[model samples]
Target: MPVLHALKRIGVLFLATAAILCTPGTPGAPAAADEPGWTAEPATGRAATARPYFYLEGTPGTVLEDRLALANTTDQERTVTLRGADAYNTAGGAFAVRPATESTGAGSWISFGAAGTVKVPPHTRAVVPFTATVPPASPPGDHPAAVVATEGGREVGVRVHLRVSGPTLAALTVEDVAVRGKGAGTVVAYTLVNRGNVALAPELALRAEGRFGEVPGRGARALPVELLPGQRVELTEPWPGAPVFDKVDLALTVTAPGGARATAAASAWFVPWAIAARTGAGLLALGAVALAALFLVRTRRARREPPPDGAPVPERAGQTAPEHELTGTSR
Candidate 1:
């Protein structure tokens, strides 16, 4: 009877271990590639989650409530700092979050119920409730933000997409354009500004013409910059093989998403000073020689031709004109 009881106990222990090993993990708690043990996500709230980002839409003066989930998959506890920041596209066109120290626009509007710092036990999640209040005079468009978590020098975040309800205006401007240098070593500089309430990936088309309507350099290229709302960036484009000696008319046409367009122009004179100086000197020398020849020709003609009726011809030192010639009478 002792042996039978021992065998039954052993079988029960084996079954219990097997069951524990076969259990599945919690849904949506999968670890990310960059952050192996930490993950931040949006929790259940008035906002809707479409995959990895949260979408919240409301009118001005409205308050939207949401929650952020910070999960720690490691065996040790992790202390993470939480904050909100505005989101924007990188130069490579990838979506990214702003720095923790900066909290403007949608980032400033977010308020959390818990402290800025939170600690989560091993294999547990910390839920933080947050509210985003839209200002009464907020512009209508998309305002992106994120709830970020930083732990042990590693940071993870979940995006918050806020759309204010009103008319959407997309405006942009190009200003302060100029052309510098000469010939093949020229540069076209300009300033691109976003005047509306949205981001822009601007496309540039450049055209340069000489004084005689000759196209010296023309091209269309896309800039690797993401201009944010109310932001301005000074950029330059290399213009090789530009005209060497002519008045150049440089025009830049910038276009972006949402039908934003602007055109700016600048004119510059590209003169080779060394060559111009040499040519001018040669012209002046030729003019001096031509004036000297004209003076000699007038002097010789006066000596050969007869004097006018009332004009008197002066006599030489030891010679005198004949009386018949002086009286203009035939001999």
Candidate 2:
């Protein structure tokens, strides 16, 4: 009976622990693979002032203060750890944050002071204040980052779009342009590098030319990418109507807001080599047959023709010309 009582108590404790542990499906949790039943976002003082992300701007050597809101939707108290992390575009161009240990740039400048960790009761929210102290030597422009909350190995991040007041530049380059496959399967692959201090939303235009004239190409369109400063993304554009039997010169023109523009070019020969090889072999075989037939006809004609009016006839392979006795007269 005592052992049964102990087992019941242990089961209750386990259930309580599970409820306290943050799992996905929390109100403020990022819609990631794991469901943590909590949410982290920019703190809005009043419900009407709901902000999606933190936006801070200041000059160098200035400190900017903001609040982050963490909501625990579970029926148990939730304990979470807070930290700052650098934000960047993944190679696939999705917004992501670096691990806290890898934080540099603006992320390193953020501090929560004494509120680095907090415990929130069931169905409660906590507002934590944080500050970003820009160093005097910090460069001017956008330094993206995020405030991350972790509970029981599950993490949620709230974006902080911070910018240091100063001159901003928007520039980008399209590199490594190449054409792949042929016909309906053609694709143009290239890399887009952000070379300036600002984020860019790039638009791409494709043009193709053959020896005769301009061919069909894609019209100017915006690419679904948000290129971060100093980051590059490799991408591909489909060319479903690629030529089948021509040498084509492909040019890609990419442009973005704030006067950002770039161009890259590549060349590809869209020849069906398999079909060409078959056709060439057939032609070669036909030529060989024609030549053999012509040779046979000429040989028969030469054998039927009389020796050119007393010209010396050539000796046969097995017989001499009878001791040269009137070889042309009787042969």
Candidate 3:
């Protein structure tokens, strides 16, 4: 089979295996509500914008995972209270299936920090972490949920969504992910590590996978990489555009080195932030030093001998004042 086709087949099998591994009601199944919260402006009080964009997923009947962040851009200090966790089914369309108050915020199914009122100071943000699982008979599609916040009697909220596209036939894993920042942009490097116990080859491709970044493979180098169980190699992915985040995950696909088996991939984190921040700070320091040096030179010059423009008046050191000639001439 052609490399691409083989990879497609491998991906299909991987999903199939995942679906099988994740029965509809396995304790670890994807939660009835996978993701919870609006991506951007959760309410009209503010525009749509998730400070730290988030997404979640898990096997059917398995554990759910989540990460939520809130940013403060308002002018005044406010108190944020969380409530109203509602779940929904988005398979056919928008449909509410569960309430925010159900389930205990409970168990590993719904992990929350302190379910009560949490103070969010001005100009700061916070995160709410959670998890969930699907019931055995829940029909598959997209499931969603939300966490609401109330302040000054006004409410702001966010939503999360999860897609139950069935299960995986094989365990698909990715590795060696890395990123480097270029002014307003970044460079990512990574390699695929195939850990499945199958002699496989798959095709690899990537798309928008991180918080906010663009990937261009032109100068991107996909190495003559091959993978075996426990095998890995480094590959460099070029990101030519500015990303909106310090770190983010991406989505893509890859075949085994032989290009026989292919698997679809969701991204992990790509962090190019620390270096960028350091580089920016370093440049700023250099500029400050240069300015300081210039100032010092000017100060020293001003205190030292004056320039030609400020030359001293010449004078005869020993000449006595010339006696005034008193001859009065008639004009």
Candidate 2 has a TM-score of: 0.80
Q: Candidate 2, which segments miss by more than 4 Å at Cα?
A: 1-36, 47-49, 308-331
Off by over 4 Å in 1: 1-55, 65-76, 86-104, 120-129, 152-161, 181-185, 216-221, 271-331
Per-residue CA lDDT of model 3 for 1-331, tens digit only, reads 1010011212111111111111111111222223332111222124644222123444456555554455555555556655434432222112222334352321214445574465555666665544556555544433444444455533433433443445322233555565555644565565555454332344556566344444433322243332323334455555665354434455445544333344333344544578779999999999999999999999998878545776865565887766876668764
Write down the TM-score of every candidate. 0.58, 0.80, 0.29
The alpha-carbon lDDT assigned to residue 100 of candidate 3 equals 44
Ranking by lDDT: 2, 1, 3
A best-first ranking of the candidates according to their TM-score comes to: 2, 1, 3
Candidate 3 — which residues are off by over 4 angstroms?
1-54, 74-76, 87-110, 135-138, 165-331
Clashing pairs in 1: none
Backbone clashes under 3 angstroms, per model:
0, 9, 53
Q: What is the lDDT of residue 254 in candidate 1?
A: 88
Sum up the clashes in candidate 2: 9
- Tens-digit per-residue lDDT, 170-273, candidate 2: 89999999998777888898999999997777889999998755679999987877777898888989999788788888999998878889998888888889
Per-residue lDDT tens digits for candidate 1, residues 1-331, read: 0010011101111111100101011111223365467667766434833234555667888888766777788999989887777765443233456675666779777777566888889999777777888899988976867666677766665656677778766689998898877767788888888798765667899888788567656566667666666667778788886776888778889887778899998888888988999999999999999999999999999889988899987777989666643566776
Please report how far candidate 1 places residue 39 from its true position, in Å.
5.8
Q: What is the C-alpha lDDT of each candidate?
A: 0.68, 0.76, 0.42
